[model samples]
Target: MIHGSVVHDPTGSWDTKAPLDRDAHTALATAVLHWDQHTAPAPAPADVEQTALLLSGYLDRLARELHAALETLPHGQLPVRDHVAAEIALSQVRRWLDGPSGAFQGEPLAQAQSAARLVDTLHHAVDRTLGAHPPTAT
Candidate 1:
């Protein structure tokens, strides 16, 4: 379902273009923030199928957006490690999407929580690459 490989064109988009546009970056940031803030509550047995469907769709959309963010990376702007992490996150989401029953260990909310966490990870990486804010000292 989810592949682990990360592919990039060395002389491609980022190499020839400016950094991600402010508007695009902001939109991605907003999406990340929204997903981060919205946590899925546990679903009842009857609604499990519907909840799984919604989460699967959300994961699909988020994966596309993450790919877009990756394409917008300016050369040398973000470390290669960040990009790899984003790819891995996307793959994790994909695995859930491609699952036979779309269940994460037999729990719908658990699956959604997993996907949301992956999205959060990608969002943080993209935000860092875009210089949205300084990483807070822990």
Candidate 2:
């Protein structure tokens, strides 16, 4: 069943709750599966440019949220090693955004790549902070 199902609650009490970590993992996995099935290659230049503008705004919001989450980690609780790993991942993300790989690609490709890198960084940080496995390689 999907994470939220009316049938699961027969009592009609609408007692819904947000997903916990495991549920989140499952949902993300399902989403990736669906995306893989449905997504096609990058679109034409006009569409790409329009999409890029929107994607850039979304990425900015995501970056802010990531920064906030990073701040919430307890000082001693966040291991130096994990921080270093996150730093490395973030650097890779930046490189992807700034390097030659970003130049020739259509705007859609560029945007998608940028978003993927951010997701990678986010996953790494979340795994490190929660002491959980790096989420099942979606």
Candidate 3:
């Protein structure tokens, strides 16, 4: 069910600061690398629904993987904040997934778009977390 690349800051927690601070060189780099808006023409309702379902599943799986990694990574290699960040980030993604995802509430398209962006952000965020501090080679 997973698809696409290019993550973004759907939760806005990536930078862990104000919008202007993102450009500040002194700011600690966030898990987010980069992101872009969806530019394609509006999709059909069916397409949107399918996309949402697929992304929701993918995001859920990715979050679980990240959560497990955060919990299991060898000690002395992780800062407490690393686990904290993973908790907060995954919580935000899960909250969104739990919403509207059940019944495709209010605006189906909007829900779908939200899922798309969340998935994108998570993709990069998870990558940043593991990539920056990869497990030691065996």
Candidate 4:
């Protein structure tokens, strides 16, 4: 049984075929939420490290999925706007990776805020990407 949230077609107005976009958006939203939850505070150093590692893995997976989706698109069919949004999302993840450990080396409040911002950025990008590609019947 398919037990999960169902995303409506993005291009329903135009009656385009957009199964891939729907699936991608759903997956991206899931990842963003997972990161947000794990990144919250009150953990030991070891636990924080583990959480970071997991988030890194998730980011890597997302990158691979985005790349594959981009690869599958034909030149004309490629959603340039979506690609740009995804790129921004990827850049935000990279920033967190490169950001100083000290930046998150404060109280749980600060850490949670930073993490939340990152997750929000990711969600925004995913939403933009999903909206950028209208469903196309191909």
Which one is best on TM-score? Answer: 3
Error of 3 at 5 (Å): 29
lDDT for each residue of candidate 2 in 21-117, tens digit (9 for 90 to 100): 4344334333333333136644465655554444443333344344555676667666688877766665654554466766236545455445544
Compare candidates 1 and 4 on TM-score and give the better one: 1
Better of 1 and 3 by lDDT: 3
- In candidate 1 the C-alpha lDDT for residue 105 amounts to 61
Q: Would you estimate the TM-scores of all the predictions?
A: 0.51, 0.43, 0.58, 0.44
TM-score of 4: 0.44
| Best-performing candidate as measured by lDDT | 3
Cα lDDT of model 3 by residue, 1-138, tens digit:
998877685864553332322122111112111111265545567766776676666566667667766666666556666656667778878788676546367565676666666665666566656765665799
In order, the Cα lDDT scores of the candidates are: 0.55, 0.49, 0.58, 0.52
RMSD of 1: 11.4
> Per-residue CA lDDT of candidate 4, range 25-56, in tens?
44544443444344663446556554445445
What residue runs in model 4 are displaced by over 4 Å at the alpha carbon? 1-41, 94-138
Model 3 spans with C-alpha error above 4 angstroms: 1-41, 79-82, 100-103, 132-134
- In the order shown, the candidates' Cα RMSDs to the true structure are 11.4, 12.1, 12.5, 11.6
lDDT of 3: 0.58
Q: Higher-lDDT candidate among 2 and 4?
A: 4
